[model samples]
Target: MRSFLLLSGLFCSLLSFAQTDTLPVFPETPPLLEDVLQDAEEEVDFDFDTYYEPLEALREHPLDLNRADREQLQEIRLLNDLQIEAFLEYRATAGPLLALYELQVIPGFDLPTIRRLLPYVSLRSSLDDFHVPLPRMLSAGKNELYLRWSRTLESSRGFLLAGDTSVSGRFLGDPNKWYTRFKHSYENRLSYGFTAEKDAGEEFFRGSNPQGFDFYSAHLFARNLSRTVKAVALGDFTASFGQGLILYSGFGYGKSAATMEVKRSGRVLRPFTSVNEASFYRGAAATLAFGPLEATVLGSYRRRDGNVVVSTDTTETQDLPAITLSSILNSGLHRTPAEIADEGAFHQLTFGGCLRYSSDRFAFGLNGVLDRLDQPISRTPQPYNRFYFNGNQLWNGSLDYTYRLKNLLFFGETAVDPNGRLATLNGLLAGLDRKVDVSLLQRWYSHEFQSLNGFPFAETNGVNNEAGVYLGAEIRPASRWRLNAYYDLYRHPWLRFRTDAPSRGRDWLVRLTYYQKRKLEVYLQVRRESKEQNATDYFGPLDRLVAHQTLQARL
Candidate 1:
């Protein structure tokens, strides 16, 4: 036991010595805190002037073709204001310049000036180079392509319930949908493909078609036009006319059919309201721009076929021809010689108007024929007048002013027999006349028509008096931000057809949006609506409120 203890002590001593030998050996030295502090102080006093002076001098020096605003570019050696303005304007409309050589494209920016400016100008910054190359190359032969996809969910509720039926009971609605777009471009031209949409909501209304996968739009065009005019032609397409006054054929308005159902004593009481097929118009259209004066003319034909009753009822077919013309005139005071030379902007008081005419088959009006074959019916073809106007005609005119202060824009219009609530007209004729036929109007009606037409029944005509004013102002405080807003008021002379009674309402909408970067955006909106009537036993008070928040990104 004694011998073993001696051996253990020797082994412990050997381990300690080995551990000590493994450690690093160094000379003893004092801390250098003083030296470090001195070095930091020297750095604090170093001359930033060496870096800032060059930048200041560069800023003070006027830029030539590549790095200058209109005025500064004009001051450079041989260039004039007109040439400078033209160059800057072109650049502004085009985009961030990619190379100094592009300056030669500007009028009066000759090769010599471009060469002189090259040393002082840079097409890219260090940060810009760090990002992915723009006009991203997609393939060796094909131009770069960009694709985007988005999804949204929305819910809405309305204020009034007209009957004890399901649609009249609660106004709860939800829609979930997705969208995808693909685009490819070369030079000044582009080609695009789009689709991707879905609908999920209550059965009473048709949500958007799952399209599930329908090609919504596929087209190719040159966005930048040749010298005097701009134009586009479509092979097969959809379009809108003058705020949709005459024709508006697009997808998804009536994806869901509005319906009403009632049940009593555990038995189905009433069948669903008639399900009207969604409307789609196939056509081609274009706009012509001579200058400040522009015009758009469109013509389209549509057909709708559907059953009035169950599978046994015979189908009804209808055809419609729609046409519209819109024109704008502007004074030529500030126009360039090219504008005046081109005979585009004429020197005259500014005015404009639009005319839209549609044959009867164009719109979806209420069908009076009942599905029961044995029932008695009136045979007057339900007064089939394609043009249902409470007043005289279907023409609209407006007077406009373009002032020098930021080229302020002011316009007002009045329409004769404004077709729907969408039309805006000007003048004393814009008021509603109580004696006019209240039965032919489609959108908003006075209480008299509602009572006369009966609950849950759809009618075309109503009170036609509608007048409103629109004023707009746009100001950009920064390069990446803008603001705009508008207000509208509408009035009906008769409240529920009470002679000498009037009801009025107002709608307000405001929006603000910000472009945080080239591909990112954020926006906020507020909307409010109010009606002039108090609650009646038949219908609730009329009022509505809505608010929206949105963020969008593109890549």
Candidate 2:
């Protein structure tokens, strides 16, 4: 944890850079985004670049509300489905909005929600120029460049031992961290950029990284190319579909104060500008539209870091000793010989496609994906890992749907692995009245079910071996005060890492927020969670499971 905090401090230089235009380069993050970032920073698996791109882009080119669609509005990350639906319904009946304040009349658009939405949205005439020539678009596009450098004020243990060649675990590079990026983009139509980074104790222009930075990523994305072609991407990018059961890449929200915002929504293909190496794909993808039907296809091939184990025993199927992998490394740190050896040690190939049909009230889709690895994965046998994935090849297929009727909305996804294992998630959102809204979701995953790239709403970390139900509500008692609350109950039928036996858990949260628009904003939040875990006082041969509870309050 100390090392992670140091790395975050290293990024302080990143915020010191100045943009050419000097137009509020990066505004203060909204409350919702701020909360998500705080949670992501605590877990080192996420790349900060993923969150920065969208915010920067929106600041540079605000969305035109009159022309924005459902998906575009959701991209702001500040509005929930209930609000979006209400806004769309209001727009359909009231016609193109003439002013930003017109939103006050829309259902679910309270003062706080409006304040959060103000910066990223604008009221533009629908009759604005619909088409522009390629040359003009290229000449008018925006360009940005950023460079940052940082180093510790004093030498740490890693630096003291770096020069000792006899020490195998010593750092291999200097103590500085460097980052640089260049981006060019036009409105939302086209974007191309490249980012390079070198972490502390990593090689730079020598040793293992003779070419320069230890990691480099580039991408080219274009949308609304033609009437038939919706979007295209080359180089690096991410894909998210349905409710994120089978395939979802990039950052996603789990449990938050906005309880009804559990469903995942976004464009299928988005450009990858983050430094996180493991959560992106390098290749090409395209989305085509035909009337009410749309199709997306993609292919990716990349080398990944992994812990490789070479066996001494010979196998009957081959002349050489068998080679297997114990785990895939995602930290993106290579400061020692052991860490460097694990870098790009294995190859992965992924191919997938999705087909969807949509209307104003409902939508349906089918998704399929295949992943193959050059080396097989073999985990050390353990009672808890009996259901973990092994071998080299995997494939999954799923069906997802969404239907909106009056004030009620329904969404779900059901997926299956090659072995017939099942995983499913379903949810409902209802605007009970002008002052209240409620949500309910239920999920079930077989013990053998596994999703290597899925990040869905669940009690556990991943989307497997869990069954739970969630109920949440949001109430606007008055113009300046609002309340939010939720309760969740879950159980694990199989043994967990710390708990030696089947366990169950329950969690609940309540938050009250006060809003005065631009004047003042404050909130009080309380949460308590209880779950079964091994007891520390037990002296029996077998560990005893006991209920443990945690309580927290924040303002």
Candidate 3:
């Protein structure tokens, strides 16, 4: 009965709070690394950059500081958001916190964010999800097994037509590129695993993968459960709300050197152990809590591998000839025969939901998503895709926010596309003193903003025809001297892909360091960028239109 009237209105709002008020015990978020999902696969065009399975699941699950949260303290990108709200307002006005030298008297806690939370937080004590024992959480905690294999020592004519048994340019498989993983965890409540991969000219267990790793993933994550179902997932998952537009299947990091890490922290639901086969979302997702309102729900059905385009125009009452989908084969490589005839052709069904309301410094969220596709998406006729997105369905809606006062802080997200186009992202992180810090960001996507799982916080890498402005800074002044910088200015009005007009860009970064106290360190860095392209199609005599500049160095 509607989850029993939402658990009897969450037990009458937990009997109107005050059962000696207590809440804010979070921890159990580990599994992220590839320099942290490499800026959302930097506009994916990969040739290779392995993501060692979430750094072996954070080297076997780590992240616990009086149970962390704030998206696991913003994935230790080295505290921002005013030093994670001065270490949670100094552990909620003094209580629980014994050493780490009481964060040298909080207030924008520094010392390089306590030396990056001393290798993933601790000061333990916060493990009691009441009588855990799923066979002692599966024989007391951790277990891992991973394997990798690769090939490509030059020999591609489809691996020489797979040993040439004729069939010109053959290649129905075999070139070796396999990976396997198995994980098991406990102490964050529990997690299950499985992952397998193969893609080096596909074919593994024979012709077009006769069931033998052509990509496979599995998962089971649980947390708190009966404590008001605070988390749950079964079989591949990922979800992100806010600052990511509608649904954001995690992956981030941009303009690095940890300058406020350009916000977009996740964990509205997680566990999709990356192998990036068209960015996770296999099935089921959940999170529920009513003490400060939090409710997340998700559903997914996968089968996405592209290429199925047909359109010769004619359909005003069947005369056949109108099937679409041209583009979307996210390199899950399927070894030639025209990429094994487009692998899993296309079938995606997603439905997501979120509604949040956090406390202690405010927060709010409302996200929605819907995507259905089973052959229908015609593209090929451009002027920068004249407002893309065709048939087979797409829907998105969002409204996100966060706030703080006292050394200031704020965050934002706004999305819409019921075919009315819109996208927005906002930020500010100030704390200018106690050494210094500053950050500000603004984004406005909308060249017909569309999202089939957004990734907001951009400079192109997919978040839709850009519009940007960002500024950042950090300075230590002493105490092992430090400095950081950032700058971004962008525009991409339309035409993309080998650009041909409507473009503008700029990027800058600087880092300088010199630490000592955990055994010396030194650093120096620089970067530069500029864009607006499409040059050298070999035409000079009075030719025109071109621009480029890229540079980076360190010492």
**Could you tell me every candidate's TM-score relative to the true structure?**
0.33, 0.92, 0.33
Total clashing pairs in model 1 = 18
Give candidate 2 misplaced runs (Cα > 4 Å): 1-20, 39-52, 58-60, 126-130, 133-139, 151-169, 315-317, 536-539
Off by over 4 Å in 1: 1-178, 187-189, 194-196, 201-215, 235-281, 288-295, 301-408, 414-465, 469-489, 494-502, 507-529, 534-555
What is the TM-score (0 to 1) of candidate 1? 0.33
Tens digits of per-residue lDDT for model 3, 86-122: 7777777787777767886776665655764565566
Tens digit of per-residue lDDT, candidate 1, span 1-555 = 111111111101112211221211211110111112222312421112111222222332323334444323422223322234345556766876776667766644434334444544555433211132223321211222222222232223321332223553332223322233333332122222332222222211232223243124344433224423233434323333221222232211110000000000010011101111122222333444454344444332322221111123333552433111111122211112222222221111111222222221121111110011111112222122212222212233222111111111111121122222333321111101211100111223322221111111111122233333333222334545544343445565443222123556565444455665336555454545554553333333543222222332212
Q: For model 2, how does the per-residue alpha-carbon lDDT over 1-555 read when each residue is reduced to its tens digit?
A: 333333332222222223345432455666665655443425553444556556666765678888888988887778889999999888888999999999998888888788777877887555443366656555566776666677776777878999799988899999888887777777678778898999889999999999999999999998887778888999999998788888998777776777777888888999988888788888999999999999999999998999999988875777798889988888889999899999998999999899999998999899999999999989888898899889999898899999998789999999999889999999999999989999999999888987777778887777788899999999999999989889999999998888899999999889999978678879898888899999999999999999999887889
Cα lDDT of candidate 2 equals 0.83
- The best candidate in terms of lDDT: 2
Q: Give, for candidate 2, the lowest lDDT window spanning 10 residues.
A: 9-18
Using TM-score as the measure, which candidate wins? 2
Candidates 1 and 3 compared by TM-score, better number: 1
